[model samples]
Target: MSNAARQQSSRTGLLAGFVLAALFMLSLFVGVIDVPFHRALADAGALELLLISRLPRTLAALLAGSGLAIAGLIMQTLTRNSYVEPSTAGTAQSAELGVLLVTLLWPSANLFAKSIVATATALLGTSVFLMTAHRLPPTQPFLVPLFGIVYGGVIGAAVTFVAWQADLLQYLSVWTNGDFSGVLRGRYELLWIGAAMLVAAWMIADRLTIMALGRDASIGLGIDYARMLQLGLVIVSVISALSTVVVGMIPFVGLVVPNIVSRLMGDNLRGTLPVVAMSGAILVLGCDILGRLIRYPYEIPVGTVMGCVGGIIFLWLLFRRPAHA
Candidate 1:
């Protein structure tokens, strides 16, 4: 709350914004098409490509990356678990199951309908994870995410079994990997829902901060602990569901980016939210661009790249941190 702290937070936020903007520009340039930026200004074909493909792709990446990261931070704070996030905590897998079910039963359901089902499933799955974690002793901090992985695996296995039986394994497979290649104009509008949730989260950041101080503490502080916690979890669930429904599952943007931002900016969600969101967007955009250029045409999925990178980062966090974490 001091002047120096405010200035530091401002600078960190500004830096994140700069990085996000630069990456967005780079993302527009790095694509399958070989249009020069100079020519795109005047040429019809190039201009159209920029508007239809590149603009949408950039927005999708921005939304997916930032949304998941904010979701992770919210879960971490709510549960007081450093490792809990959409991917590790089974929220994304749960959403994936919802998508699979809708595809199998309805077969012709629109994206909004699928997203609705996916969001409900995700909320249920995340609530189960939190309840299970809540029942365990506080001594074991890592057990929460470990249980999440097992819980998610079981849910994922059930989904896989159904997909195999129904001969929709390929459809299920496509949603698990995160790629921006399919992000055309009409396809990616669902992601804006995720963006809206982040704004909602910012609006209630202070209440969530109070809720994070343990139920007893929040209650003693005259906060409606249960209501606020549920609201926060709902927001997280919606973000997880919409991101999965819109662009498939992109892992580690939630886990890695939020952790890094927390380390740099401290635990104040108000100060760190924008930075965390921006860092997530910047990191994903960088990875997306790398995926595009690495093979010159046939691009790697952004989820795969983030998975590999995030796995290493996760290992480092697992090994290098002190026992107190």
Candidate 2:
């Protein structure tokens, strides 16, 4: 990394850390049942609320954000496309389909079973996307995820058809509309899978960086390109699945956070990974806090706010492409 890049990364890291801390504190104190920040430390009940409720929710946000950012980084690097992400590429949607299947086939499925099915389905969907993209000529790499969107829509329609036929539309709706309010003690434990994914991502960061140079180049360098791609797809699938299972479908965090970090800090995964993770954490937590504040006692889902802001940002990026190009 250049000295300037190092400095920028450090600055971003500090800012992200500060934002995460503030989010933690805010989540603990600010809720429908307001616990005064000053008094919460001393009051047992307030401390219990902080420890049991807000702390877990905050942790879930951090883990999910970081995990999804890492997933996006890997996908972009593997595909050599800035626009690609788990959400855009049908991984999350496939996961949702998996959840829907489990719920319909066996309504009493455990969280771990649901997550496993989701992960497997996500891996399959991502593999199909990669295979399809590989066969296409390299005219516009950005269009790959657009293909994924169509693919996702098709699979999503199938899911919807089955769901409607089974009269489980309400159950399916939960997976479509992301919500963090349901995160608490027993329920929020599912986010630990995201923590595991974060560790796995860091461990394989070097291999991913090498593979990002393209298949021919990576093979020339004696790296197993196919295996590397499979590993990366697995990571992306598992992380996206877990996040969707926990918080529902959060579309643009994977795309937007990693792209922002790559532009600011450059595209090396090792260097930008931490910044991407932190930025994602800050973004989600900030959005969640904003959602709470905007509606006051009646909180808005974090997913709703992200979708609104992300849509505007996506449009802005679309219009600004010519200038950047």
* Best prediction by lDDT: 1
As a whole number from 0 to 100, the lDDT of residue 191 in candidate 2 is: 78
Judged by TM-score, which candidate is best? 1
Per residue, candidate 1 scores C-alpha lDDT tens digits across 1-325 of: 5677678889999988888888898888887788897898899999999999999999999999999999999998888887878887889999999999999899899999999999999999999888888887779988888888899899989888989999989888578888888899999898898898999999987777777778888899898887887888899999989988888888888888878876666777788888888988887788888888889889998888888888888788767775456
Expressed as tens digits, the lDDT of each residue in 233-286 for candidate 2 is 888999999988878888788888887777667777777788888888887887
Which portions of model 1 show Cα errors greater than 4 Å? 320-325
> What TM-score does candidate 1 reach?
0.96
Give the TM-scores of the predictions, in the order they appear: 0.96, 0.95
lDDT of 2 at 320: 63
Cα lDDT, model 2, residue 17: 81
Give the whole-model CA lDDT for all candidates, comma-separated: 0.87, 0.83
With candidate 2 superimposed using the best TM-score fit, by how many Å does residue 178's alpha carbon deviate from the native? Answer: 1.0
How many pairs in model 2 have backbone atoms within 3 A of each other, for residues 3 or more apart or on separate chains, i.e. clashes?
0
